[model samples]
Target: MTQDELKRLVGQAAADYVKQHVPEGSVIGVGTGSTANCFIDAIAADRARYRGAVSSSEASTERLRGHGIEVFDLNQIDSLPVYVDGADEINALGHMVKGGGGALTREKIVASVAMTFVCVVDASKRVPVLGLFPLPVEVIPMAQASVARALTAMGGTPQARVRADGSPYVTDNGCTILDVRGLQILDPVAFETSVNQIPGVVTVGLFAQRGADLCLMGTTAGVEMTDYRN
Candidate 1:
């Protein structure tokens, strides 16, 4: 199957998983991106089964609302049963590099409050290490240069993310993204913590500190589920 088909397969599987695991009338957390968009469409068939959703990005929020699913603000919701999202890349340890679409900050925030993070991705996203994909780091616009310097000191190439039109890619939080490359994140937790301490850095796209609790990997064969907590 093609990659898009694989994404759809996992998306359906995630919707099924949610129905089985999350209780009725519970508000779940939704993620951003194409794969996550597929999940939104699949889950829409059973929209009434859940109370509503807390979306990770404005795009996802619009999509959720378009499907007649109510979207709730994070502050209004205390906890989430599950956060279903896609990962740019994932390792055996469930570590992920997200935010290719520039929603890292919000995605991380929503994931933090969830009881379980259900990462849905295609087989190609599975990797032996976590740094192959450019690590997206959200930073204040004025501090972009300083943050880049700090990232360079850490032995990586930090390039300011830009759009097709050549303008800077601004995130939902109104900050710019620095896509860092060339560092093998052997210790994700430490790497995440250290980068977060850098001044002007809002948050890195590393999901190691609170990585995925479960991963639904889509393959040509079918969806493979792994519970990291186990």
Candidate 2:
């Protein structure tokens, strides 16, 4: 199947999984990106089934609003019952590499507040280890150079991510992204912490120790569940 076709299958499976697990009247945490868009579309198709949605990006909020799904600000909600998102790359352990869409900071915050984090992805995205995909690090524009130096120290080659218009890619939070290449991450949690500790670093795309509770992996046959909560 083509990439778009595969993404659609996985996205549908993910939406179906959420509909099955999420209880009515619960505040849902919605993630950003193409796959998450699919989930939003599915949920919107059945608007009355959900109470409200907490979006991780402005773009997501607009999409949900367009469907009449009540969108709540993160500060407005104390906690989210579930957070459903897609990853650029995910491993068997549920560790993920995200931020291709520049919403990593918000995605991480929402996932952190959620009771359960559900990752949805196509089979092609599954990897034995993380880091094959360039890791994204959100940094303060003022400290971009310093943060880039720190990433190099960590054995990665850092490059500024740009938009299609050739301008620096700016995130929803108005931060910049440093795409780090090279380096196999052995301990994701430690790496995440280390990167965050750097001055001017907002958040890293490496979701190491804060792994997902469940995974909805789409395969050629259909979607398969990988339950890690047990």
Candidate 3:
């Protein structure tokens, strides 16, 4: 199957998993990105099953609302049972590199409040370690240079993200992103902690501390489920 097809497959599988595990009328946390968009499309078929959703990005919020799924503010909701999202790269241990679409901070916040996080991805996204994909670091606009220097000191190439027109790419939070390349993350949890401690760093794209509780990985064979919590 094509990559798009694989994404749709896992998307449906995630919707099914949520249907089975999450109780009716419960609010769920939704994430951003292409794969997560597929999940939104699939879950739309059962929109009534969910009370609403707390979205990680404005794009996802618009998509969810487009599907007739009510998008709720995180502050208005007390509990989120399930958070479904996608990853850029995921290791054997289930830690992931996300934020390729520049929604890392909000994604982390929504995922943190959820009882379970279900990551959906294609087989190509699976990796032995977490750093093959450039690690995205969201930084305050004024402190971009300082953060880049700090990241360089840590042995990686930091490039400020840009738009198609060559202007700086600003995130939904009005922060800029520095996509750091050329570092192999052997220890994701430790790497996440250290990067987060960097001044002006809003949040690293490393989803280690609150990584996937379970992953629905799409392969040529079908959707293969891995329970990280187990």
Query: For residues 1-230, could you state the per-residue lDDT of candidate 1 as single tens digits?
Result: 99999999999999999999999999999999999999999999999999999999999999999999999999999899999999999999999999898999999999999999999999999999889999999999999999999999998999999999999898888999999999899999999999999999999999999999999999988999999999
Reference-based TM-score of each model: 0.99, 0.96, 0.99
lDDT of 3 by residue, 1-230 (tens): 99999999999999999999999999999999999999999999999988999999999999999999999999999989999999999988899999999999999999999999999999999999878899999999999999999999998999999999999999999999999999899989999999999999999999999999999999999999999887
Task: Using TM-score as the measure, name the better of candidate 2 and candidate 3.
Answer: 3
lDDT of 2: 0.88
Each candidate's lDDT (Cα)?
0.96, 0.88, 0.96
| Model 2, span 1-230: residue lDDT tens | 66666667767776777778888777899999888998888787778888889999999999999999999888999888889999999887888999998999999999999998989888888988788899999999999999999999999999999988998898888899999999688788888899999999999998876878898877778778898878
**Regions of model 1 farther than 4 Å from truth:** none
True lDDT of residue 19, candidate 2 = 79
Clashing pairs in 2: none
Q: After superposition, how far is residue 24 of candidate 2 from its true place, in Å?
A: 1.3
